[model samples]
Target chain A: MTQFNPVSQSAGGQASFIAVDWGTTNLRAFLMNQDGHIQAQRDSDRGMLKLGSAEFESVLSDLLGDWLTPDLPIYMAGMVGSRGGWQEVPYQQCPIKLEDLSEHLFWLTTSLPNKVAIVPGLRGTGVAGLLDVMRGEETQLLGALDWLEEQGRADESPIFCLPGTHCKWAQITEGKVTQFSTSITGELFARLNDESSLVKGLPKSNQLNEDAFKKGVQASLQAGGILHHLFSARSRFVCGELAADEVRDYLSGVVIGHDVNDTLEALKVVSLEVPKSPVLIIGSEALSERYALALSSRDLTSEFLAANEASIRGLKRLANRQAVSANNPTTGAL
Target chain B: MTQFNPVSQSAGGQASFIAVDWGTTNLRAFLMNQDGHIQAQRDSDRGMLKLGSAEFESVLSDLLGDWLTPDLPIYMAGMVGSRGGWQEVPYQQCPIKLEDLSEHLFWLTTSLPNKVAIVPGLRGTGVAGLLDVMRGEETQLLGALDWLEEQGRADESPIFCLPGTHCKWAQITEGKVTQFSTSITGELFARLNDESSLVKGLPKSNQLNEDAFKKGVQASLQAGGILHHLFSARSRFVCGELAADEVRDYLSGVVIGHDVNDTLEALKVVSLEVPKSPVLIIGSEALSERYALALSSRDLTSEFLAANEASIRGLKRLANRQAVSANNPTTGAL
Candidate 1:
């Protein structure tokens, strides 16, 4: 039931630490040296959704293996910190300084030396003053800011688009996350394609049909908005205008296109530089490129920072600040 | 496997015919006399979705029971005429006179008798020139139009909104369906409330929470569009701004509100009298009321007609034209 948080007696000299990006469907870990350079890495399907709350300790410990030393602190982000996850860490409110994430680290109360902690997610005011929340992506945002600072582009406020099942569009003012909105674009596409009558008999294909994808993006830019554009998939397919192999990608375009469009529109309501400002996409190369294509189709520029690297940089940044936070934690007592 | 279409020899003297509204999930039949009066009605869950193409005849015959007679013609509408239904009746293009439906009836070639036919669905160019398809809704639209004409409102080009699993918005100009669009509002709401993570831990209920539902409608009018508005359900729930019991209705509000908003916007792109014109809503009292609530919040005037009346009147209207069609069919041969 327990991986017995690595005994403090066995931990002497270790300049290494572990960073785990544990989300709903996937998990990845990194072992970094004193300089925040990756020494080793491991990836698994043991996501928080697949494990019971009690199993988190064991699964995580076995994952770390030799890397699981008491002095080698472990930091986790995403759904592992959610209510049904390992510890249910509370979210920190934003307009939050990305750098202050380490100060809000929720340390687990293990019997042995304390080294395990979850990077708290962020809850911020979204469009129309409604609330929005993000877990792992907040840490990724922290890491992305770190990556941008290294490139000396930190001062230039660019909208961060994290493309995934629940896509997020965040705006950074200075070093703090001023505001952000989440859209279930990917999930909606999946549900309609798989379950709804829209793509009932349509063959499913994973390959992206570039032409259809871009056409869908153009359709999304039209007057009907998404609900109408979505029907266009069924309508076009039935009319034999869109091919069987193109339905999936075309759907991807419609969904992501609206996501990009709606978010930009919402951002424009708050900031003047939105439509003009370039976007920094923090996600996988494949998906981020899709976002990039959707953006470029609208004549907007975008750059990608590998999502994994951003999370690692985010965790390392926190690890560096961990010592400072330990002496004088800014977070209120739970 | 065959229900053996009535042998025609059994005909004596019968003035009754069947009008079937057969859809994906349910089927209903009305035994109507020559005077357009319902003699009897039967309903079943044996929708087209439940039976194979070969089994339609048997199922219909069994449902008809003692009502089955060679002299009685059966006119069916909805998905029953879809490719996977009893027969794959092609869609009739729009800017089409609703009264012309009987001319396009897809008469099935029964060896014994030619009494079975499917009321063909309609195809129309929706927003951005995308082809939109509707199966049963076309017949319902016809019925609604007939009902309107009887009330001396034939010249009025009211937007016909049939809200259901796949809600449809139709514009009828000069007794013809000029344009229409289908929004996956109801289906989207069902999918998110049941399968998506947005309502993962939330309680489900059938009761409509007016406060929450209206809030969602109001939310849709804001800058972020439906995609952003959808996430508000989860975000608001997580922040304790929304209650568990209210999630479902609230979600319905958001989806239906967007459905109403998007379709109206698309209609305005072509028609000048859209937002100002009255909307004739053809659906059940309860569901139509929700739509009415959504419409009224935006200061739009709407009137409801029982969905069943619309379908029956539409079928009766077609029956009156069937003899005319038999003499000179307007539809090209399959």
Candidate 2:
């Protein structure tokens, strides 16, 4: 919802740069003038899942054609660099900073004469004391950090959670992502509702049942034993207590319950000392609101960030930093 | 593979009966002799999923040929009576005896000359203090109970667990299924391994990883808060500590963990005074054996029964009881 003019002149005629956050299932393009203000923006279904590996460049070119020339520098992020994406960009293990990601970036060369760089995904130590992998969302967390800094409210350490197809919970300390964990909660919910017989009889809708959702989240967080109460949704339905449409809300609760539990557990194991830090949640409005509600039930406070805006801001910051380094020789170049 | 010899002696010289165990994706037929022996067995691809509705009888006729004569009576169990199956037979609520199911039995008249009877599935008060729904396997549990009674070993209550696509846990007390529960653990396991990207790169094999499966079962039993440990299999693979092929085992662990957790929770809620009752597990040899091993680790004893045998035995018992009831009016019969 933040509006910016692409053709606006900020101090000079030279535009700052364009930042494109390209992902597997969606494409987001942002044209920024000198001050990291988006001049124009566009989104399309040319995501990695749809285009796959071979057609990625052609699709990218097709989407960006006439908006800019092929030689225009574009910074990409998300699953675009995953193994199944356009290219296999190796993952950068956390604790990673913007500089670390920028230094180890993967570039895509096409017949089109353009400079395109893909930001690497983040892999971190998992809750089980193993490597946890994530793609695309790390840069958005960086953008969120930049936004906080610009607001002059940046903290030494912050916990940012980006909930989506793959929910990423990152710990940013001193501008570095010290650690993060990923949960495929969204995908799991979708699969259970859409494909599985668990909710085969339930109607499909975006309608949310606050009571059911809260109950599920609470049960998920408070249920002591290892038992999963996901099937309880159907059980509730069969009992004639829950309506068909409310099954979706119940499912959302189950998934969010598991997500909150996992994130809490991971933080406990890795962080050792539970810092009473305010959590920042970055996701779509609906999902972010749900996460906010779930967190609130646990007496946890958080700041919600829109996924698209966060990604754009994050890429803009990266482009600006790169441009600054390219213009001034005194600052150490990443 | 226990073979039974047909009983040659009957009121009539001819054998006129058919038994079927029709599940979600598979159909098995038994051409039975007067003595409850399989004269000729056949299987077909006309499972519930394939034969939408109108083709159920036609497919049976195609499979049976001359066996579809009017003089013969066809008895069927399993999903063929579910909502998606040939006919939606309302479930018989438990604390139900075999006699209760037979008393409320519904008959389906096909265009074919023969009489067809579809066995009703069971619904029960769930261990979670909810309504539990089940089909197909409940009839098999009844058969198992009949077989136990006939063997003169029916004093002790037995826990009959039919683990497959939908694992059914039935408590058979005094030659009757008093209660039951259903878990979608098997279906979930299959989907995660075969369809989901979580184990996208894993190799396919039917072999069981005993170590992984047992560890998974144990972990599921002990884990305190949530079922997120289910994803540890993927994490292990992503961490490079586990080979792609070994992912199957890790998945085995995840599913079994949840299974064990659910089973334990169910048992706790169902049995008020009895804490250490022996469980009878019936399923495919491999999965049943894995569950047995899992049970053994907790110093609990379990009896393994093949699903095929149990279903066959159940059908035989039902037919025998029906024959007896038809012959003698005063005798209380199932």
Candidate 3:
């Protein structure tokens, strides 16, 4: 791999670029020089959910001002472009290239004189004939691809599972994300534990009780149907077997069981072979660990990737490509 | 029909009977004599979701003081016998008869001086099998059968649909419940509307907009998929085409759509040859209205039966039979 120097021929000197990945509940920003070295970073709770459209620009500008000057060019992604975000930028359908996204990009000039370009999220009609939506993850997947290409191991169509509030599994072929599916497993877990009667009497505990989760998973898999397994959760509690805290794990198992089942079923419809294939998981440590356990339960091998690293690397690759295109007008596709 | 009166029986001759129909969220009880007159009626918040095995008897006693007095025969049914309920009473498979239920009856009596018999819910397994769990409704269906027998309309196999929390469809042949299936349509609706994000932002109102509900039923019948029509409510809201309160109607549409789809699907599997058959719908007025609208949407006809009436009649029939069977060796099969 070639290492570029941290210098650029600006009229006076070198300057750093900023990349922001914004989601519903959080915002993460990365500052990189010309060489793709992370010079600074910032995070804030002024996410899309907290900041409605009217207050988004001011809140974001206030946060970014601490990290960089007002005139910096900022590239953003994630729910910042969603209907509920700063601007309602339409989604670019999947099997989409970076250039397709770049073409449909929305630029906003803040009163503080900063130039901001928000990356469009990807949307696609899945094989199941349902609309699948994603925002910041597509950019991260592109970055993972760039990293793989740098390593000279980017030939295989790797299954990238990005697990978070909304778990996304994308199939990357060559350098493009061909298709993906989203599961609301995390949100369902949170709601069931906090608001639902399924765990009404349960105690608060965050520790993953593998035994209880496994029991739930097994019961969910073996039960005749979804409704039957739902009752079993209550039955387990009533039978004096499951602790209140363990209900969370059981709920997780129920959701994961359904998710895996549906995903596998969807894959079969598309004739995608999963077993013995490489599965790449990207997310937080805890979620990745859970995914790993779930995969192992189904006798599948998986590789874990750090989500932050992937997103940063992806932004770096985007920056590099943009820089190269600026230098060679017709050589690099923008 | 023979009218037998037992008003002149001795004080001890009056058989004390306890009748109960324990549903998911409600429990109703009736104290009766040998003459099958409701001496007193009671209810409590001690539904299946609230109480467990340890508290079941105490809750019952608290609700019924004189009713639980010495020598009273307590008969109960509904979710109380479910696996998640107070006790794990095994299900009596479908094609079950009154005699079958009586033969396999399980009794639970404590030192509280009252005889208690918890009626078993129905269960069916194997290929093309179905299980219907009814505590109060089963007795209602039995009561309906007794009414039919008295009316000399017992020869025909009447199709009875009890639509409520769990909609039960039973085929009665020769005054016996030959087969029945339970659909958790009510529970599903409650969960989806109250808990799911599908209609999270929609306003709540109970006014039944029949026009919107009918439109939804039509769309459901034509489209044959739920998710497609689910977003109609949101779309209607976004486009300013629907009132905030009309969300109830939109919900009605989605649920009725599902109910119609499920009914049609189940009917297909069961291979009902006569589309214009005289189906009996026994349920609450609100649900019965919905069912009537659904049937009309499909160009099918049905006779509506009040759930409470059927249940009361059924309990009376049980009490009357018990009174006669105590004296006659073979008056009733049980």
Candidate 4:
């Protein structure tokens, strides 16, 4: 990783292309060199939910500033390609290969005289045996697989866990996304923060109480499951067993613990109880650490991949594939 | 039940006593005769959470109006005796009997010249093997037991299920509440309504969609448990399998179904799988109906009891017990 020297990159270094990961609540833009190294990056709150249909082009243009030069290819993924985004790019059906994502790109020619390609999401059967779709996380999964391939672990089928508001657990085999499931754990935790009995009399600081969190994780392993375990956040407090400040983290542990347990159980094939390999956890450091802790509790190991890096790698993979297909007519179909 | 004729009651009916159920969000005052018949009932928003420490007396006086006679005794339960309530009455230890509660009442003489007794809550081991306490529901359970006693089933060890913001499943053996477990199902449902992906395009009507709710109940019986089942609300919607109006009810079913299942499982003793008798569900008609549906899904039958009647009965029982103890000083210790 290079230290961000904005002046040096803006004046001397040749800008190769731009990659963007636009989600529901925020947007991240990365300027990358030909070698897939990020020269500069920017983030904004102008996500899909915050913009009007007509405002997408203007928002992107302003976000890019001087980088919006003619002939500069741009790649974008996530909610930016959803039905409510800048363009409604239909999801590519699974099992979809990471390399073929570029072929299914929804292309748009902006007023800046540059062609922008929006990567399509993936659709498959979820953990509940129902059709599930993920817009932004698919790109991250693709990028994480790219990291695995570079490490010579290409043939190993690994479970990718992405922790977020809607945590996703995906299975990838030979660079193809076979299946995935989502657990609304983080979203539920945030909701409980405002209205749950666990929130009452909570401490003002946002720092997590680790002891309480661990106790919650242990609680999740007990009988009664998530529904019964949830009330303990309040019941313990009322009985003077848990302090008010510890309630929030305790609830977090409960929710996240359930998510990890259920996801791992869902991943089982032929009624197998034990996991075969170490899971790949991709997300922010804090969330991944919590998931890692949960996985560790279950005698499972995990490897961490930063979500931002995965997104950039995924967008770069799509762009490189597009370039190769454009130059070689025989491989145009990707 | 007699028709509510306010003018007739205000003019000549002899006021027996005021039975009050003051919870966190709302308060109910029932003017009952000596026979436990309600002459008139009044509900207000000035619950424990809504009143300041000094405002309790004035609020109760104002709410009672002409019923605030010096000779009239007031018996209050629920959060009225909680830490944030009018007076922080300590909780009574569990394995408690209905006939013994009056002896443990926290009696207070107000400036209004009437002595008010607040019912103490019960504390015992919860579902997680941690200490649990229920403030208002203990009184309701007492009244529910009285209902059973009237039905000639007082000696039967029936499981009483109370559905509300915090649903409780209590085991009563020979008119004593031996133990109970609470599920934060209702609060979780309400929280999800505002902050969940399931609520994105939900219909404005509060009415439950029966078909959708049934589907959700069925979904709960499947693999992955509640955490994974929750995301199906969004997954099905994204796949065009579920309508916007169905999302809310479906989510409701998932939460309630899990609550019922876990509670019933927790009730099992000596590894017994089947429940011995029909579960008694005590609450408002609407909420009880939901629980009944979920219970039916599990091949379990449930009997419904109005929460108001139970509160009145419970309060009357406590008052009657106090009267009997007054006559026999040897049994006053309870």
Candidate 5:
């Protein structure tokens, strides 16, 4: 809810481009300089789900009213380019690099003067040879890789996790997204709280009980798999072992723990010592913290990155990559 | 949905008692003979959730309008005895038998003439020292044990699975319910289909797709646990590997498979061959079929019993036990 209006008079109205992360239920836009720093930022609840395909143009224009101008070069990512989004952009096949993303961008021809390009989401084989898709998180992963490079860890291919409703865990190998899987962890947690027996008589509280959460994480490590473990949230309550207020956080821990643990197991990452690189977690602060706790519980290390920052950086990176590719067409062609 | 109206004038109005299976969503009442045979049966949408505590008496009266008599005794099981139901019957601890249930029954002191008793639910240790509670399934389990006894398998300790909104798996040893676990498989499946991405665009059909379901069972045995396996339902659909209509059954398969698999693992009944006794699946035919299928897929054999029949048998057995205890207090005392 923090509004960042960094557009100052000293900049002399020299904003280079606009970066937008429009997902299922949220829209965040950033005005950046040529150096890829966010100069100003704005957000709204006008996610892709809220706007009709045709209304997207006007909504974007209204949101960025002060920043809009001819030839501003607008770049967008996430569900805004999905089938239910403004433009139904086909998913770009994975084993793709950050440099190749711009070439496969779904270019939107607009009545407005600005050239609009929506980054294509990625499609790849998930666990067990099943197909998985990610729209917005692919951009976040791209930005995370860039952040790693900036940290002089460019050679490191840490697993990048963008946790949200549908959490995406992508493995970056040799600067390319080689493997990834999507787990419906957040959505599942919300749904279980809303509908399952775990929250039946639970008292509502705004406090985040870390102890309860840690207990849940511990429960997840026990036998019976996730399905059986899920019932423990309520059963523990029924037995007077877990308090009403603690059930929610405990359930949260169980789910997040399983999500992290299972994904790692699927990737064949057995021990913390095996993976030399730390896991890179990119999401809202609250969600990332939970993932970090779960990872640490398993003795796996992780680094956090704010989702908004990653989105802006990724959009800017893609834009810059496209600009460079335009000058030398053969090099970055998809 | 088949209504059984078996009350006959030629029998000279000789109905013995009424056995009720009053759960969270539906109510089934059977008019029984002293021999425990159901002479007539009726059902309504007057589940525990549908009626207020004060309205339960009226609802029961309305459902059993013709069968009510001042001298007749009524026995009810399931959520009708839960905290929010007509009467909050306390749960009897595990390692209990059918004979002990009547002694623990929460007898109602009503303004109505007929004597009524709500069977106490059972509470027991589930997986990893966690507690599990079952309201109606205890009666089904009791009845299942009786059926086993009738089959000359009384000495055999078999796992009993009563599948429903919350499935209960009970281990009966020497006529006593020693341990049990409750898995929210049915509720989870229904919630996922209604609310999760797994069945977002799935087509509506009354048919149960066995092939699709079997495939899900196969997938459940693979790596990544239930949380990861859940996403495969949607991911497979996204990749055109699974059709919309097939997704529901597939999800059902995944959930049921995990439920059986996890519970077996928790009980340390690994490889099915370790337990010589076949799993006793007592529930509605539809649900029991699915559980049977899941068990068979794991090379675990199973037997089925009708829930209504089991409830009537259980109620009758408890009532007879109560009568004998009343006649000979010290001999039948718990």
Candidate 6:
């Protein structure tokens, strides 16, 4: 693996390409110029899941509007590269450096004539040596790496906690993503908070009950493990220890707490160097803070990055590297 | 708590009462004669949950037909006694002998003039001192004692696993329920297999793939715990390790296996005696056998009792005791 180096884009003022972050339920796009600056941004709910009947090209063309230049290259990340999306891109295996992302880009033979490519996802050995896969987080992880090197923390091997519907915990050593694990904590909480008997009659909201949520986090470290602690949400509510409105947040705490603890424990079990440095928590402000709180509860420190920005930045770097390589064919590393 | 004594009915061969096991999803009623024999049996899908708008009495009346005799005392158990049921009967605390159930039966002031009653639920300390609950399983636990005593196994102190949508694990010592825990394993599996991304677009069914189910059981014992292990259902499928039809049963195995292991571990942690004798698995034949497989995988022996029989036997014993005490005002033991 190469030592982490910030990719410097070629000197050009005009717009270069577009970056699309397509996931299961939402689509986000960033218009990037020659030097990795966001020219403009747009978002829509026409995610990969909703593009079942709608053609991906038509959706992209419609959403991008006048920005849809035939010559401007577009680099798409996330489920847009998944099986059901615009095209199925194979996942690249782990232990690969961030810069390698540019070389493995799954270029499309689109109607626009070699003007589009999808960032292939990553697969790695996760907790218990079980196979774990991530579609979108890998890009954010690359952005995370790029961001870290820019911060002059490139030599630091730290754990990355990307909390979302399916949270990803990546262990980056040197410049390579050595190993990572995935937790369905968010998705589990979503399903239970919405449909499980645990919250059957309770008031439903995305609003977090802070104290209740922390109580759930505390419950995770208790004797019974995830399957049992989950019942605490319902039992505590039944016993009047938790209010009806607090049930969802309390459950969220329970699952998220367990997710963080288990992933950390698994990393420890594998003898990974859990850095003394604060864990890099990459996601939205609310969730990242929630994770930071959970980590702090265990006396572990953490920092955060907006997931969208991470993806956009990561895609921007990839575009820059690809552009630089194309401009100077003799250049090996950006 | 008093030692469990077999409740022999009064000397008479007349149709005396009915035993109704009404839960959230289904209702089963057994017509009992003067003794503990089931004279007739009937079942309906109009369970307590479905009785939201329909009157419980009207539903019973429509289903039982001639069996709904005004004077035919009906002893009901399960969710029929829960908050949303026919009547809200309070839960009896643990450490009470099975026979104490007779004293706590919340007799209803019904249209039939003191001819109807709902057996209460049970509450107790569970894993990690977290309060766990069970509504319908109490009646089964009572019946379990009756059946055990009938088999001259009254001295047994065993872990009782009543598997269902909400699985119950009760620690029975000296014929008394000392402690118990509830695992939402079945419910979790139902929701995940039917709805989650783990099994999304995969084949869905209640059929168990023995190989796949056992593989899941093995997976539970591996690292990363439940949350991470759960993703294997999807990860394995995406990587072609698990087949489409096997996903449901595999998930079933994972949850059931964890449920069994966690409950036992919780019992051990709480310093409760997980008896050397086989864990008593009470439920439908298929579910009971499934649990037995899970238990055996941990090198634990288990025995099964038809859940309906247990409930019927329990309600029958309660009826016999109530009838005997009513028949002979001076008799303390029938």
TM-score order of candidates, best first?
6, 1, 4, 5, 2, 3
Candidate 3 structure quality by residue, lDDT tens digits, B1-334: 5343332253744746777877778888877665566777899878988777788888888888876665666767777877667676776656667534555445664556766666666553211242234455667787677666677866656568787655666776666666565554565457667765446666676668887777667655532134334444444453455666765576567666556555555556665454545677888888888878887776777777677667666656654555555432231122
Docking class of 5: medium
What C-alpha RMSD does candidate 6 show over the true interface residues after superposing them?
Answer: 1.3
Q: lDDT of all the models against the reference?
A: 0.80, 0.69, 0.64, 0.79, 0.79, 0.79
For candidate 4, write residues A72-104 as lDDT tens digits: 678888889877789887878888887788778
The TM-score, computed over Cα atoms with residue i paired to residue i, of candidate 5 is: 0.92
Candidate 6 lDDT (Cα, 0 to 1): 0.79
Off by over 4 Å in 4: A1-13, A269-271, A327-334, B1-13, B269-271, B327-334
Candidate 2 structure quality by residue, lDDT tens digits, B216-243 = 6654443222234555556657767667
Top lDDT: which candidate number?
1
Candidate 4, CAPRI quality class derived from DockQ: medium
Compared to the true structure, candidate 2 yields what TM-score? 0.82
Interface RMSD of each: 1.3, 4.1, 6.4, 1.8, 2.0, 1.3
Evaluate candidate 5 by giving its C-alpha RMSD to the native, one decimal.
4.9
Each candidate's fnat: 0.77, 0.09, 0.00, 0.74, 0.61, 0.60
Lowest summed lDDT window (length 10), candidate 3 chain B: B124-133
Q: lDDT, candidate 5, residue A199?
A: 89
Instruction: Identify the superior model by DockQ, candidate 3 or candidate 4.
Output: 4
Superposition error at B102 for model 5 (Å): 2.4
Q: Residue B175 lDDT in model 1?
A: 76
As for candidate 3, its interface RMSD to one decimal place is: 6.4
User: What RMSD does model 2 have?
Assistant: 5.2
Model 4 lDDT per residue over B1-334, tens place: 2222221123345666788988898888988776567889888999788888788999888888888775567789998887778888888888888668888878775777555788889888765576678887888888887787777776666678899888888887766777777788888888887767768856766676888888889888876768778888888887788888888888888989889877766656422665667888989999988999999999888898899888888888887776655533231122
Cα deviation in Å at residue A194, candidate 6? 0.9
User: Which 10-residue window of candidate 4 chain B scores lowest in summed lDDT?
Assistant: B1-10
Model 6 lDDT per residue over A214-303, tens place: 999999898867878888788778877899988888888888888888877777788755568889999999888789878988889998
